[model samples]
Target: MSAAVERARAMIGVPFRLHGRSRAGLDCVGLAALALGREAPGDYGLRSGDVARAEGWLRAAGLRPVAQGRPGDLALARPGPLQLHLMIGTGAGFVHAHAGLGRVVEMPGVSPWPILGWWAVE
Candidate 1:
């Protein structure tokens, strides 16, 4: 598998923790930033609950929207009209920190959200 996919998959089962950005625990943004590596900014965590704000933050951090994506790309979606979530593409799937499950996990299908877009770390 791609290195990004490997890394993201490796993080599976990590407990979810709001505002967390490390192995101890992580939220969706933390998983995305961790999987994206140094291309992500130092303060990449977001708890704003605003899709527009989260998208803006990713843009400000040097990520750019892409027509399509591959493993290692970033994905954003609106789980709720006002709530944005982040995930890392894993080639055939995606990996993310899920609040409901209270951990990171890999999902092997299209997400339930209305995808806002995909972004490349750049």
Candidate 2:
């Protein structure tokens, strides 16, 4: 597995918190940043409409948009009409901080939401 994937898996079960950035609590963006070893902005709302800002952060972190997600890649998904969620890709699943679950989790198989974009460190 990729080092990023390993890093993400290590955070399973962490409590979810809006705009949180640490192990104690994390949101999807925070989890993705921690797993990918990058810094993310905290000035965002629960229902963010600024996809360009998020994309900019990903790009600034040395990630490039890719055709599809593989292990260790980042996925931008829309779980709701106004919700933009981020997740780390595992070979067979994805690691994300699920607000509804109140913790981080690894969901197997295809994504449950519609994927908007995929980004890779390389």
Provide TM-scores for the models: 0.86, 0.92
lDDT of 2 at 10: 96
- In candidate 1, which residue pairs get closer than 3 Å at backbone N, Cα or C atoms, i.e. clash? none
lDDT of 1 by residue, 1-122 (tens): 66767778889999999877889998887777777774444554344456666677888877899988788888887787557788888777789999999999999888887777899877
lDDT of 2 at 106: 97
The per-model lDDT (C-alpha) reads 0.79, 0.88
Q: Which stretches of candidate 2 lie over 4 Å from their true place?
A: none
Collision pairs in model 2 = none
Global Cα lDDT for candidate 2: 0.88
